[model samples]
Target chain A: MLDMIIDFFVIGAKIGLILLPLILAVAYTTYAERKIIGYMQMRLGPNRVGPKGWLQPIADVIKLLMKEVVVPSGSNKALFLLAPILFIAPSFAAWAVIPFDVELALANSDVGLLYILAMTSIAVYGVIIAGWASNSKYALLGSLRSASQIISYEIAMGFALVGVLMASGSMNLGEIVKAQDGGLLHWFWIPLLPLLVIYWVSGVAETNRAPFDLPEGESEIVAGFHVEYAGISFALFFLAEYANMILISVLTTLFFFGGWLNPFQGIPFVEEVTGWIPGIAWLLLKAGFFLFLMIWLRATFPRYRYDQIMRLGWKVFIPVTVVWLMILTFMIKAGVGPWFTGRGVL
Target chain B: MTVESVVFYLFATLTLVGAIGVITMRNAVQAVLCLVLTFFSAAVLWMLLEAEFLAVTLVLVYVGAVMVLFLFVVMMLDVDYASLKAGYTKYLPLGIITALALFGGIYWVIRSEVFGVEQMPEPAKHGADYSNVTELGRLLYTDYFFAFEVAGVILLVAIVAAISLTFRGRRDRRGQSVPMQHQASKEERLRVVSMESGPRQDGQEKTEKKKRIRRKKGGGS
Candidate 1:
């Protein structure tokens, strides 16, 4: 009984560790976006509610909780209720596969990259369902646009990952990072510059960031698929979006930037000298830098026309990735890869 | 059966039931939800098979992206629930015959297997690093690299086809001109006008004033 109790507690504690940080990070991320955008646009963002809007997300939570959920009269009420769960659950679940550090991850499966991709992809349904179930025209149009955008970008993203997988020879994120551990120069980014560019662009498009953010383009569809959503329902959608952004950022770090590997390698005093900072901090820092770029892109670029977005993904990204994939294959076959060996990236 | 076997059966049953629900359900939205259940239970089954990659991919791709799109389209279609019921009786005999044939064929194939050397029983512990993902990856990029590359090219072609089929310019649609927009400078977009000209009346002045009043009213209410 004592052993069982200890096992349950350990498992429960691990579950808590995953859930608490995710929920908290998601909540704060909203505040960070608002504040950052506000600063960039030259306006004060959410300062009245709490200290520099630190507690504003908390207030938003309270408001969402207190507000009565009003289901539209002529909607598929069952799906209407379930859509939020479908959206948020997969966003949360995808976190399980992300290896924050060598030791720290919720569930370290061998197919970590595939698992994350699959979960992130499934999240689009929530947006689609929200738009459809609302029985509203704007929502439907938004969802349709989102579906096409996500599916198109996913092809580019997957191909980009093919490049990373070739370099690493492993599908496991942990193993991928381990493969990148010689130094900064040895990282996949040095040799696979094309894949890096494609991955980053596709990452922006995948997360539905600005320039590619036609789905929620405020002027076009009045908040897109979530237009009919209000209160907590809207909040769930918000959480999912930010969660997805974080997931993509982490993936970019893991696949491209030798995740958690301090760039100044062979220096014994690097991580140990900075031992006050946890390994998870390095992962977070890399992820944060990418997140900053995402926000910067949002601030910098105008939303692309729907056709233009499609053209960019299909005509440009897909072709470029395919050609590079051929080159990478040839290099790997000829033993010209950065870390040349008989083993292809597993 | 042991606990593991019992659990496997439970998940398998759930997956099959969920799949059946997906097809038979009258409500299109309900069908999509059942599909989600089907994906989830199938993932559970894949866990039993030690095929974590395929299982997780099933959840991530099918559950996350594809089904979401499916649900979205299904929900927005303005589907006439009554019209669907009208067609069901008309096609009932054809459907029944097709279903029976499918089931029979499936059972026949499942029951008929080629004789091979006696299968090795799963060891209490497999050899060090016997991961399916690793072996699969090695096999794919080495011996199957040509097929993998071809599959990629096929997907690329499919993507091009999908885009071309859907791509059409709409003059009525108000969207940003990418080249013209990208050429924008800070000076053009933001003018440091002292709050001042007291929020200058360029293009959006009247609209902004109206919005401000409406926001005030809404906030007050």
Candidate 2:
């Protein structure tokens, strides 16, 4: 009994380690996004709060927490309440599979990619429920768009990932990163260039960023699916979105950029030498790069028309990914290049 | 029973209850909700089976994508609750007879012993690797290569068929021009002509010069 109690605390602390950073990251990410977008727009953003608005996220958090959650009159009260939970749960659940470092992860399952993919896919429900439960047309429309967008993009994204899985031959993220040991050129991004590009673009679509963010196009849709959400209900959606952005970036790193692997090789104690820099920093840097790209796209491109977005995803992305998957399989079997020779190559 | 078995039974009960609710619910949307619940509980049961992959896939594919789409369509349709209730008394005897016949057949199959009730082979003594995904992949590629390839082809054909069907009944005069849309380029869409304002400036072109500068600045932003 005593041993079991001790194990419980250990397990809890382990879980807390994963959860706490994510919460903090989600908070700071909002600040980073605002600051980055602020610079892009040539405006000083959130400069009033602590030190160039560094503490602005905290103030926002406090305000959200203090605000009263107003349930709409006609909404399905039970499901309305459950929607945010459903939305938030999958975001947290997905963190379990991400290998921050080789040894540091909440749940280092062999099927880590699949698990993350599965959890992320499940996140659609939160949007759907939030849309439906609001009993509002705008909410419903937003949800419908989100469901279709995510579902379509997810298929293309999965196929793109299949190319990576084909190259690496392991869903284990640690192993995938280890395979990219030699240098950046040897990374899966080189041989699987088509996949990398497809994955990146589809990932943008998956996260509803920029041109693909038609669901929440402010001018037309009026905040899209979460239009009815306010106060803490709205805040959950906000948290989920940024967390997902982080998740997508982390996945991109693990899949393509060699998660936590030192870029320059043969340096004595490379990972150890960088003890001053935490492993989480590399992961964050990669995720931040993708996040920045997402923001940049948002700032630059106009939103895609609904039909056009669907056509691009289904017609162009899915087919291209499918063809590339076939070519990758054939190349691997036929022993075409260095990828075939090196078992260690990711 | 062990704690695991007890938990298993609880999920099993939830699954059965949800399944029953799916059939009995008068409201079509409520029926769909029950169906969603059934899918969720069934996924939980898959978790009990030690098949996390299948469980998660069930949730991801079925609950996440398929059922939500179902709900969207079902709720939007003007399903007549009165019409659903109208046939209840009239069709009761016929429905009962059909259901009884199906149940009897299922019971006969269970008792026939054609399929043994033997337990699954015990997992390897080394314990679970959680790497069953890799093993499944190896088997699919090597041992079942032909079957796997055939399945892929079938799926591809189905996708092609679905897209073709979607395009079949289009009567709109301005139907989307696939080839023309594909051929469209930025240069064609936005034309640039150079015209001197007063003197021949170094960058006198309006759109072209502006575009060149915009493109370069756009690179960083």
Clashing pairs in 2: none
Give the docking tier of candidate 1. acceptable
DockQ, prediction 2? 0.31
Q: How many residue pairs clash in each candidate?
A: 11, 0
Interface C-alpha RMSD after superposing true interface residues, each candidate, one decimal = 4.0, 3.6
Tell me model 1's lDDT, rounded to 2 decimals. Answer: 0.81
Chain B alone vs. reference chain B, TM-score for every model: 0.71, 0.66
For candidate 1, lDDT tens digit of each residue in A1-346?
5665676688679878987887888888888888888899999888988677799989989999888788888988888877888888888888877888886877777887887777767777777778778888888888889888988888888888888887777888898999988667767887688889988998888777898989998998988888877788888888888888887888888888889887766567774666566668888999999888888788788888888889889989999999998988877777664565564544
C-alpha-based local distance difference test score of model 2: 0.80
